[model samples]
Target chain A: MIEFFNVLLVIFLILSALAVERTKDLLSAVIIFGAYSFMMAVVWLLLRSPDVALTEAAIGAGVTTLLFVGLVSRTRRWE
Target chain B: MNDIIVKTVTRIMVPFIQMYGIFVILNGHISPGGGFAGGALIGVSLILYTLVFGVGAAEKKFSHRLGDLSESGGILIYLVIGSVGIVSGGYFLTNLDAGFLKGEAGALLSGGMIPLLMVAIGIKVTSTIITLFHAMIEEDPS
Candidate 1:
């Protein structure tokens, strides 16, 4: 069961990564990146590193994505 | 992502997740986790809230100065805890001879200063990471 969860999580991570790269809308891309952080956090939990996982969830999904989205909203959508 | 659904979900989830983060930070001793993990989780909750609500609203929530102060404060806490061992005993971070606290194996406060240090690290990591994120988002004057 855990293994299946791991696999599914990995798939979600990959999908999230692709979403971040491929999305036309910057906000959507940042959202996807947040998804990627969440997936990574799950992976960390599975690996028995809740500390790293927590950091991943916080920094990745929380701060980094928020910052990017803020920048996007403030500036032009694309660089 | 700024849809009503996202906001609603965030409203429902942020409190729970943020609380869990603090729980994880405090319970790091017996478990496989520590301060850094839990602090990050807390950071995420705030971050999620900010992302959904917009930066202006987020800025109103907390100032950059507070974050920076917290970062330094965390480090100072860790240093103070660690230094107690040296002040009381021969070596730095020497838990047993440091005369800080009883060394019960499984109790919450039994880890002497380990838990405290972990909490400090958690504060340091979360604040620093958040500040860095803010820097990235804030307009570069150059």
Candidate 2:
């Protein structure tokens, strides 16, 4: 059961991550990236490394995304 | 449908989701989770709202600048606490000999500053991610 869940989680993580990087809409990409990072954090938790998960959540979903968004907000949209 | 119906309901849901995030962060140590999982989940929730609604709404409720500061603050808090252990004759993050509070393992007040630190991190992450999502949305929707 645990193994099954892990596999499913991994799939979700991969899908979300792809959506983040591949999507053209910046907003959608940011949202997807946040979701992707959240899934990664969960995987880290499942692997019994809460610390890694915590940092990822903070840095990935938290800070990096913020920087990206802030930058985008200021820049004029190309399209 | 940019109408009053959705806005009214979303206003209510926001607080609930935010609180739940705190719950997850606080309980991270005991359960199969920690600050990151809970924090990111909260961050994503906020992002969903921002994406569906707008950046102005999210900014009104949650400050972007504050979120940025909080992210750095969380890390500083964690490091400060860990450093205390070293200053008190213990290695970094050494709780045993560290001159700091240590309560029961399972209790809310337990785990010394670990739980507090986790909570701080959660707040930092959630706010940061939400701010990021808002920035993206606020970008020219071309």
Candidate 3:
């Protein structure tokens, strides 16, 4: 069960990473990046590093997304 | 941004998020989450509030002056605490050697100077994130 979940998370992480890069809209990219961070956090947790997972979830998904959204709002949304 | 549901949810959620952050910071030595993660959680709570209420109101709640003071004070506290170790004829940040009380293992107050250091780091990270967000958003893009 854990292995299946880990595999699913890794697949989602890769998909989100690609989606963030390929997305033209900056807002969508930021959101996708946040998802990627969240998946990465889960992966970290599954790998037995809860500390890294917490930092990744908070700083990566939370703060970085907010900063990117703020930047996107200030600048152009589309590439 | 002006949605009532969002604002209401933010109001309800911010306190819980901040409380969890404090919990993480206090239990850092015994737990997985530490100062950086906890502080980021707290910072993100404020950032969420700012997003819902707007920068003007957020600034009113957490003024730049207060942010600046805390930002400097956090590091100063860390430095002062570290200096305690040196002043006591030990290496910098020396916890047990510096004569800090160590309680039982797995307890909240067991880590001597570590918890204090975590608090300092938590304060510094929280203020830095808030300051950075405010600076980024408030900058006039001329």
Candidate 4:
């Protein structure tokens, strides 16, 4: 069951990564990237490493997303 | 946000979030979360406030000077705690045997300098994040 969940997480992660790369709008891409980071954090947590998961969730999903959104707000929207 | 519901909810939720962050930071010795996670939690809370209420209000609450002071002060506090060991004729950061309190294991007040170090680290990371966000969001003068 755990391995099944890991496989599912990996598939979803790949989809999100592709979505982030293929999205036209920078804002949407940033949002998808946040989701990707969050999914990665959850995967890390499931791997029994709370420390790495916490860091990924905080820095990757939280701070990096915020920074990207800020940049998007300041710049042009289209790719 | 201009939406009243979002604004109201944020006002009600920020305090609880900050409290929980402080809890995680203080109890790091006995819990899963340490300084980095707790500090990021608090930092993200402040960031949420900025996102919802605008940067002016957030900066008013946590001014640049205050953030800088806390960032440096955290390190200073850590250094001071470490130096106590040297003053007592031991190596730096020598906890539990450096004339500091050593309560029973698993106690909140136990771990002597460990909790103190965690607090210092928490302060440092929180301020660093807030400062970095502020810098990124601000309009460049160039």
Q: What is candidate 3's CA lDDT for residue A6?
A: 83
- Tens-digit lDDT track of model 1 for A1-79: 9899889998888887877778888877888888888889889889988767766776677767767766776777864
Instruction: Name the runs in model 4 displaced over 4 angstroms.
Output: none
First chain TM-score, candidate 3: 0.94
Highest TM-score: which candidate? 3
Q: What value does the lDDT take at residue B95 in candidate 3?
A: 93
| Tens-digit lDDT track of model 3 for B1-142 | 9899999999999999999999999999999998899999999999999989999999998999999999999999999999999999999999998999999999888988999999999999999999999999999997
Top candidate (lDDT):
3
Tens digit per residue, CA lDDT, model 4, A46-65: 98998788778877998888
Instruction: Give lDDT: candidate 1, residue A39.
Output: 83
Interface RMSD against the true structure, candidate 3: 0.6
Error of model 4, residue A9, in angstroms: 0.6
Write the residue-wise lDDT of candidate 3 on A1-79 in tens digits.
9989988898898888889889999999999999899889889988999999999999999999999999999999999
> How many clashes in each structure?
2, 1, 0, 0
Model 4 backbone overlap count: 0
Which of candidates 2 and 3 reaches a greater lDDT? 3
TM-score of chain A of 1: 0.91
Rank the candidate models, highest lDDT first: 3, 4, 1, 2
Candidate with the larger DockQ of 1 and 2: 1
What TM-scores do the predictions have?
0.73, 0.62, 0.97, 0.94
User: Candidate 4: which pairs clash?
Assistant: none
Candidate 2 per-residue lDDT over residues B33-115, each given as its tens digit? 56776787678667656655777776776776777788788888888888988888878988757755677868777777778
Question: Model 3: clashing residue pairs?
Answer: none
